[model samples]
Target: MKIRKIAFLITFLFLWRGVMAQENSSSLAFSAYTDVYYSYFSNEMEPNALQPFTTVSPRSERFGLNVAQIGLAYDSQFVRANLILHWGDIAKATWSEEYNNVQEANLGFKLANGWWIDAGFFATHIGTESFLPKNDFLSSTAVATYNEPFYQAGAKLTYEGSDDFYTEFWVLNGYNRFLDNNNAKSIGVLFSYNFSENTSLTYTNLLGTESAEGSAVKQYRIYQNLYLNTVLTERLILIVGGDVGTQSNSKLPNMEETAIMYNALTTLRYLFTDKWSVTGRAEVFNDRHGFISGLIPTQNSGMQGLELWGLTLGIEYKPDPNSYIRGEARFLDLDDNAALFSGSYSRHKRWELMVTMGYQLDRVFGF
Candidate 1:
């Protein structure tokens, strides 16, 4: 059986590559990237300890590798495919154990009209922040980004009718589920509008279930994400993003109560010179029902949730267009310090510092 499966995979790859290579104007590219960092946290913990609401540069008091990835991309007039393989602490700490090394793999083709369909694993369509280090303003993620879905699997139907207005419809296995947890299927949608070259707004949402296959209580979850980007000045950029989600309370069928969570963040970046820039960010999270943040109830506060605010400041230097070195400082404050969110490493208020350097190289060729 193992031999047969390996043979089948090899054959499928050869066939797919042969078909794509036969295209009249096919383009292919290979990409490599790596991000390495060192961090320090106020709360002292063991080297193996995990940080709260952090993925990039997660470990403290040690040098770490966030990600190192190799990617391949192919595109023809009507066909496109992308595959990325990665490893490091980011994958082990935040991704699925079974397929953590596989960051993204998807195939897409155009339909009869201006519509297109893509199927496979993909980055979630919810947040402005991404897993890639160079794409984010700070070295770490905000509370909103930490709680949001990072990746998803299924299919997307996208409309390419206009450049100013964009939309996508999704049929997913479940919320952030790679292999499908239950029999239930999920759905999502995204809408983006560009007012000008420098200003845009995006809204995306998902409706799904988080219950087990045959659990007695069926809980339905709804998540909403929104962001706005604008170039406020010649050398300054501003981005605002937020998330809201709700799930059926544990009470379930008896009372139909719901648990809601919401968060917001904003970032501003100012370029001081051609190769240097500074960024500042402010963020807040509230999970009164402790639905998504994993805030468990305590004796003093029955069912009270986790509420916190944080601020970040970072400076970045670019030696060239393909690489960056950034240093950041962040501080977080909790409303009541009594509840902890991310396992045993949580603290009421904490300070952290992170420094990372990222580099990427891509080679493009045409048939």
Candidate 2:
């Protein structure tokens, strides 16, 4: 009861503030989205033992709330501020222990000559996939789950060289860390180019040193991402993405050896009508040194490498611009000796089906 009261109070305060800001001509905006789904796995794996990237529907045959998020933004000619709060499974995985439910909090200043600077927590500039379901063709891909940083706390400077080209540079605390875990900071840059209204490309890179809790060793990590989006025809679209990363000098026994991982994926979407669409995706991921695939080491078995290939087919129906229902079926093929999919036993293949419903409310309360 107490928790419910607190939640209600928070919601009320956010709405009240948004309304007052609008009335005062402060240029405030509010938006929210909710995603929920049900998923079933062919292997009947217990909920607690499901693999990573499956957190959205952790239970094998149950309904779940993936995420409920609210965002507030205030913008003026010279200054801007934004905040996002989230709840449910995505919040548990993406939010740090310190921040709890706060997904993003940032402030920005518009400088002269099309240059701008911003500081505080912000979404990562890398990856073709987004944390929000509405932005994705399917639920998610392994590359997005294992090889990307969800968020970063940092400052950045951006330049709009022209209408078609943009670039940004970042100085961050570290990957996904709200509080700096070590003395070393990460540096990254993003470059984007729009070829036309129908095509675009992006490239991103990050390099940093990370220290685990209670450990003195500093692990060096380097990561790169490339993404391309193109419209092939009036009804067809294509997306291509690739990622590569490496980590070295860990606390493991072989500090000299570097672990490497990479993935590539492509997706195609066809819109048959204004309210209906179909999508297909193919992907390959290689975790050679078990660094990003969450391999568990056993006394006798040691660490095992993982290679995965996946394909997905999905359909989406939009009742309106603000609501959608999607259904997807995914098939995963693993290496012969990989045991990550079927408990302690090795499995070469696994499959899952999922259905999701999502809604977005933008300024529904006149905010």
Candidate 3:
């Protein structure tokens, strides 16, 4: 009788364990997405040291397949993690012709009391997307800038208590602008407040040092970005914002001042249909002071100060929840005394036409 009772208890516990496992499997969720791009860029004049002219062609240099990032993420009430993999060399070559063996990865978790923590390699959460504004195209904008483009490995934490407010802080492997595993490191903090459903504001700060050519220099950089968003009606959305940044401690062989670069942009988006949308933007930039030795000063003999303006008009079409295509025409004009163009001595301007196709995957390998 005693032996039989023990056997019955064991069987009951085994059945209970099996049921719990099945329930856990049902609650787990997984998702993934990928984006492939081809880019062609051209400038009126050849590039200089600040902006190198390494492309073989003048009017158009077709940089190979930019990159297709495969993202895998898994989530549950208690934990989560994300992984991003790329096509290696093709992506590395486009970043810098010298470096190889490149990949990006990130890992994150949730803590008690609405605390979120993450660590690994990732891009800074800065600015709105330059194109395809509706999609969460965070990393893509980094690609267009060609600066701080890839993931910087480190740790980040966030506190999101309510729908109206949140704050985040991060320490990263400083602006690996292009490649990875450089000795530079930095720290950043961002605070945000959502005024309403259609409006939000953000403040950010970053500080670090960078290595260039054959030497390394310490740098103190500060930036503040303000974003104002509103829904004009059921069909229109507007976002007006600007950024001001100043950098000190550059390694320029001969110079005494830090440079100040700032930009302002106004963007408008209108939805004509559920699948079609129209967008426009006007942006201006100023680079009056060149990065001198340890001080901030005006430019030298040539057009030292640069001022440029950009205008963009585009249409976005979303065929499904997972895919989108967009076409845009960009026009740029530099000030008569700006260093980017020689319009003061000659009559010339630079322009570009771009088209983008992006896709988001819902599942990978039926997982």
Candidate 4:
């Protein structure tokens, strides 16, 4: 009788556990990611030693960790949430100074007709390139992408109906900020359309005040971003992107007319095999007034704003669906007397080499 009673108790507990597991089965997942790389620069003493508008692998001529992130996501019939935290060179260089470690912490709810409302910090929908190497064709970002926003704190309304188009409207603290730099707010929108499974275009714009609270200058900025992704052949991919922006004249000590800047780039990736691919990019940036790139200081006074272009070629080897090893060589040149960098080490041209390895843990629950 004692043995029978023990067996019955065990069976009852197993049934109860199965019922609880079924009842709590929701789309919850844990994700982790990391990338490490080695990069070298031609002029180690130049001011571009800050890596010249870069985040990943900012350490030159040495091995470094680009970024390491871990997060949790949950989605259900009515609600969803995401929380991601990161550390490494990417976070230190570009993330918000106050909330530097928080990559994303957002919550959302489903609304009528494929619409959703979300609030909190988010990766900006503005740029053509990504900081994550695996997400982009190249290991390093273009100079144009470096000037674009990387992160934002905001509330957004997103619409993704049955049509091929998707749109998002945002109200935010300010451009590229997690903390409100001033009392004023910013707004923006993004529109994306998919012509086919292999082709799409995205357009984005931002209107906001970038000046700090106590600063002497008060500037209102209007920025536009656009990009397209398409496959010219089964083995070849192409991307073209551009950015144009203008700011209201803030009458300062050196007042002037409205300031304007533009950037453009095109990238191509050719796949030689299922596991091998080569990617190349050409890019240019023009900021005539030094509004964005700043005036290149000559021996005495400030010269023209930056006018620069660059070329990059990279090869990638994918060992699996979630891991990649990449090698790239890049060349950057400044035109005319607009030499870049500072101090006694100004340079008109330089070369860079980088090799990176990346992996993602798509789902590793309770680990």
Task: Point to the candidate with the largest lDDT.
Answer: 1
Question: Cα lDDT of all candidates, in order?
Answer: 0.85, 0.79, 0.54, 0.84
Candidate 4 residue-wise lDDT, 257-280, digit = tens:
578899999999999998999999
Which prediction has more favorable TM-score, 3 or 4?
A: 4
- Which residue segments of model 3 deviate by more than 4 Å? 1-66, 87-103, 130-150, 176-184, 211-217, 250-254, 290-306, 338-348, 364-367
Report the number of clashing residue pairs per model: 0, 0, 7, 0
lDDT for model 1, please. Answer: 0.85
Candidate 3: residue 114 lDDT (0-100) = 79
Model 3 lDDT per residue over 42-70, tens place? 45344321112111111333323334556
What is the C-alpha lDDT profile of model 2 across 200-300, one tens digit per residue?
99999888887665676557888899999999999999999998888886324576778788889999999999899999999898875766665643334
Ranking by TM-score: 1, 4, 2, 3
- Give the higher-lDDT candidate: 3 or 4: 4
Q: Show where candidate 4 strays beyond 4 Å.
A: 1-25, 46-49, 214-217, 250-256, 299-304, 342-346, 364-367
How far is 218's C-alpha from truth in model 2 (Å)?
3.3
Q: Which is better, 1 or 4, measured by lDDT? A: 1
**Pairs of colliding residues, candidate 1:** none
Candidate 4 worst ten-residue window by lDDT: 248-257
